[model samples]
Target: MSSINGKTIWVTGASSGIGKSLALKLSSYQCNLILSSRNKEELLKVKELCGGSNTISILPLDLTNHHQMEEIAEKAISKFGSVDMLVNNAGISQRSLIIETKVEVYEQLMQINYLGTVALSKAILPHFIANKSGHYVTVTSLMGKFGSPYRSGYCGAKHALHGFFDVMRMEHEKDGVKVTLVCPGFVQTNVAKNALTADGSPQKDDDVATQNGITPELAAKKMISAIEKGKFEVYIGGKEVKGIYLKRFFPKLLHKVVLKSHVR
Candidate 1:
């Protein structure tokens, strides 16, 4: 297990939910944190809640801005000298059927969830390579592994991340780079509200299962532990997350069960 104390870390999507909670938790450990999100005001609120002005800095970033990623990376690295770890937690979800979904909706999802993440990773690769160490912790969904109805584009983007990061791990193992893909079930976050719809509008925030989902603080603790143990991947959530494993081993039964379930 590794200690987070003194580790220079950056977390995207830090204005709310998992990223916000993680900032608070890491602040308690005295970790140097650089937090980013499109909402600068909300991010400042999170930073204050973190209770460590000396250890926390807020840098607003919109992951969808492909042209600005290099600048974001430079700002992040410049603050901490060299980022020991990066939490790629910025993303949007879509909850519309494929047929009803617009092409632009799919493209937007891919742009933010897949391309943006890859760009950030790529931007920091040389620094990690030079230092011979870095960790990447990505917050992907269970949908990445198990396809769900009304989320064709979302699943596609998440699934693409698995392939891209898996290859990164394979190629950079000797370079001391680590990647952890976090597959969460329903988390109580604004992600549902910001999720894309058929016409590329917001989903208006309806999370039926978020009430039973684990608290973001607890989830952050679990994630930190996984990072400490150097785990390659982890699933955080209630038993609902088990569907990912069950689907792999019992495809027929899972399919039948999912067909009757009220997930959407």
Candidate 2:
């Protein structure tokens, strides 16, 4: 049996995309799940789809509301007595050039993607410490490792997650608290469609790269394996993942390639 089979897991952004896929996949493992998102209705839909022997609870959450994270964490723990893992997957994307993007857009991205994640993690830290066992699985992006055109704020927020979690991993190692950072290149989600443009409006369209990306099911499978193995980090996607390697060994070369690709 998988180590995750009987664990209690909390997954944010469970309404759709990778989060939804993970919820469904974990259900088959007999895991007790706490699914959270801004949309309670959609969370219920996902719960219904995860029909299995596992127990499923819905907790509607707005990550942007950092003030309420502690209370939400208490409620989450109360549902299952203890949470074995917390999957921080709720986030937004950006699709605007830095010059044209408004300052507020940057603040919004930081608030929801970075600060919100931190708040929730802090809220759950006490529980994890007391039990001396817990895992934090975060879904960042390829942009977290490298910068891309028109994704300044998004990249910044993802990078911040990497830094925060890296430190968390070190500090909590003796306490048996683990951290896994999942950096996905693209996984056939509506992230681009919901991405904020320079004017703070949704892009309302899918990018070519995203359209041709792997399915969420495939990404979730890879992520599950990484989690089960206690891996500190894993990357999922196509050629875009290569950029990370290039950035390390051939920075100038990757810069030229990125400029020529004309990514949007």
Candidate 3:
């Protein structure tokens, strides 16, 4: 394994799910960690679970507040003088149908999933350029690569991330700034349960495919492996990972298969 001892890492959405798992696993590596989310209480809990070591600090953040990203990034850099890597894992899920979903739902999805991520990344870009090296590991879904029945808005936002990050990689390669897009197919998390519904309220329900998917720990492991290897992109999960290849080579077939499966 690549050594990260003494390096500083920053992770968003670290209060729960894959982010939380990554924090727990990274704690063993003896690296400085900065955890961010909208929930300070849960972040503190996660820090304690990671042995409450002095290497970890919690910084609460709400992605929807795009204007504050620059300031937050400044504070994050102050944590350990410099951050070697950043894991962009904070995002929301959607479960509403295209026709039934409200316009506000789409707007909210873009604000958080696409624009918010972009803002924070840009806030940290200058630092990476000045340092001559940094890594951005963003967790977008397989839905970012293809469309699904109930995730119209979600797919749109995720797709936007790919477009922006691809260009970032191209423009910043000379600066030693690396980008890794993590496309997770599914994982047993609260994503499905907390997905926004047609009226913009939480689904408060579970999805079969998501419930039976890999554990968050396993997903976190795969994500970190991709980051360590500096992979441009990595897909994780069960059979759903094939959707990426299918969409690339057989668009029509992927469409048929998706409709037939009724995934939600």
Candidate 4:
């Protein structure tokens, strides 16, 4: 994990947002990249932006389709020889209250955000174990640690990733495999517009907070650097994520301040 140059990295959700930015950044390092997402046309655009046409390949994939996950792993191996890293970046966000959210909506969020990630990781584990070296980098969210209004399901799925991947890291540490869980508070991405509502409909509108967040390109640069260093868990954001720590250590005062803040 010390270097990415020439390493075969399979990046899921590479069509846009943080994934696209990461692919573009990693391409500059001359890493052999295998990009996957559901949108073939968008993936092509991302490949173009990454530069070095020969260094990147697009494999359109839907992470929610568990049956096709094994096929993706096989094709990735075939295209790149063997994957040195798997960036589990494909996920959907939910923006709904627990009571108002439909059961199926929560289920779908879990399938895409947590189960799909685990499925792909399980599919790639054998190869890494056999090779005795690999890295798994996941882009989780600030909601993973802090519960917020209208995001219960999203929080649940993101929290699940940390639980699952933390154990995966411990179990495979001796095998030379590394897992890094990245938590970004909010970034300038289309995630808010596409986020699921109570009935599984898209949010369709951007929030003021999300629109004013950090750029994806900047977030991507920091994430890639963290992956290269093999860090276990890192938080990225302006100051909202840091407030979670304060809320933990100073409950009464933080609770009073939070009650007056504009979280909704």
List TM-score per model, in order: 0.96, 0.98, 0.98, 0.95
After superposition, candidate 4 runs with Cα above 4 Å error: 251-259
**Selected candidate, larger TM-score, 3 vs 4:** 3
How high is the CA lDDT of each candidate model?
0.87, 0.95, 0.93, 0.87
lDDT tens readout by residue for model 2, 79-135: 989999999999999999999999999999999999999999999999999999999
Give a tens-digit lDDT track for model 4, residues 1-264.
Answer: 348887999999999899999998888786799999999999999888887488789898887888777888888888878999999998888777888889999899999999999999998899899999999999898777766778888889999999999999999999999999999988999998999999999989888888888999989988987987889888888877776687578767665665666664
Model 1 misses residue 23 by how many Å?
0.9
Prediction 1 global C-alpha lDDT: 0.87
The residue-by-residue lDDT of candidate 3 on 29-133, one tens digit each, is 969999999999999999999999889999899999999999999999998899888899999999988889999999999999999999999999999999999
Looking at candidate 1, what is the lDDT of residue 106?
Answer: 93
Tally clashing residue pairs in candidate 1: 0
Q: Judged by lDDT against the true structure, how good is candidate 3?
A: 0.93
Off by over 4 Å in 2: 52-54
Number of the top candidate by lDDT?
2
Could you give the C-alpha RMSD of every candidate to the true structure, in order shown?
Answer: 1.3, 0.9, 0.8, 1.6
Candidate 1 Cα RMSD (Å): 1.3
Q: After best superposition, candidate 1 residue 100: deviation in angstroms?
A: 0.6
Could you tell me the lDDT of residue 194 within candidate 4? 94
Candidate 1 stretches with Cα past 4 Å from truth are none
